[model samples]
Every structure is written in structure tokens, then in C-alpha cells.
Target: MMSALVLYVTDDCSLCDQALELMAAAGAPDFQSVFIDDVPALQTTYGWRVPVVHDGHRGRELDWPFDVAALRAFLQPG
Candidate 1:
């Protein structure tokens, strides 16, 4: 299986928490959470936009507030 990492980018955001729950429910794959505040570039690039899933190998990114179908599609075999 391809190794992908979901990046939950946010800073003290309740929405991020909700997104985490949503991802959990959607059976989202194992990932490394990256807080926007931790990185200047991320904070600048995704200001106010939290909960993103990123493909470590492909360098692709998917925004949050996604459904199971979206997650499934993102996690599909490539």
C-alpha cells in the first residue's frame, strides 16, 4: 500500500477537532498532524483553512470537510 500522511493543519481550531472526528469516522488513514502555527509557510498558505490531508510521496494535498466517499477516493490505489 502507498504511504500517505493526512495533515490536520490548524491552530486551536474547534473545526479541526470536528474534522478529526469526521476523519476518524471516515476511517481515514494514519497521518501526521501538523499545526499551522508550528510552521510559518503552512500558516501563511492555509490561513483559516484547517484540516487538510496530504500525500507525502506525491506531494498532493486534499482539503478537509470531506465525506467518506471523498476519503475513499483519495485513498484509492494508484
Candidate 2:
């Protein structure tokens, strides 16, 4: 099975919503949304940076305010 990207986000976060839209616009690879609120570790790690995209396979993370070019690069293999 292919490893899916993980998107960390919190409820009612406008930036998170923008990130989702950007991902769709960038034709992002398969990904799963994880609410940081539900996971303590995640909440602690990404509480301040809610709209984060974790590339588990590459062990990299893309923070918010990224453009399509950056998104494509983040999706690329290392």
C-alpha cells in the first residue's frame, strides 16, 4: 500500500482550510487529515503550526503559506 501524507490541522482554523484548498489545487498525492485536538502528541508538536503537511515517507514537513511550487516540491521524492 502507498503511504499517505498526513495533514495536521485544528478545528475552525482558516489557514487549515486554505491549506486544503491549496493541496487540491496542487493535485496533491493521497493524504489524510488529522485533527491535532484529538492527539495530544500532535497537539503539542503542531499546536502553533496547525496547517502542516507531513510527508511520512520522506520524513519532511511543509508548513503553511506555501505556494503550488513548494507543494509540488514537498510531494516530490527526496
Candidate 3:
């Protein structure tokens, strides 16, 4: 099953692309990719913050400019 981790992103975004690479490099666990462009509420909530990492289970969010270490910490069980 996919974890509660969600990566909010939009199309044609370079930073989102970079975030994907960071996710891979960090060996992040299975996560959901939410296309904010496709969802109005999501678009409104994440229009300019397309690269946010959200932990649904914990109701936490990690915004952009996160390194591998931060990613790891975010993924840790609370």
C-alpha cells in the first residue's frame, strides 16, 4: 500500500522535477503524486508551493529547499 506521504506538484515545473530527483536520490518511500493543476482545491492550496511534501498521516508539511537529510527526517515515523 502507498504511504500517506504526498508530493504536491504541477505540470511543466522544473523545481518539481528536481524534487522528483531528490526523492529518488533520498530513496524515499512510496508516495502519492498529486497534480495540483488537476485539482482546484490543490491548485489553490499549492499554486506557488508545487514542491511541497505532505505527510497526511501526521498532518505535517515539508516545503521546498529540503535536502536528502531533511527528506529522511520527514519520512521517519512520528
Best by lDDT: 3
Write model 1 residue lDDT over 1-78, tens digit each, in one string: 544675656767877787777678777777777787878888788766677888887787778677767877886758
lDDT for predicted candidate 3 compared with the true structure: 0.89
For model 3, residues 28-67, the per-residue Cα lDDT tens digits are 9889888888788888899988799999889999999898
The models' CA-based lDDT, in order, is: 0.73, 0.88, 0.89
Q: Candidate 2 residues 1-78, lDDT tens each?
A: 645698889999999998999999889978998898888888889999879999887788998879788998888776
- Better structure of 1 and 3 per TM-score: 3
Q: Which parts of model 2 are misplaced by more than 4 Å?
A: none
Provide TM-scores for the models: 0.77, 0.90, 0.90
> Higher-lDDT candidate among 1 and 2?
2
- Report backbone clashes per prediction: 0, 0, 0
Off by over 4 Å in 1: 1-3
Candidate 3 colliding pairs = none
lDDT for model 2 comes to 0.88
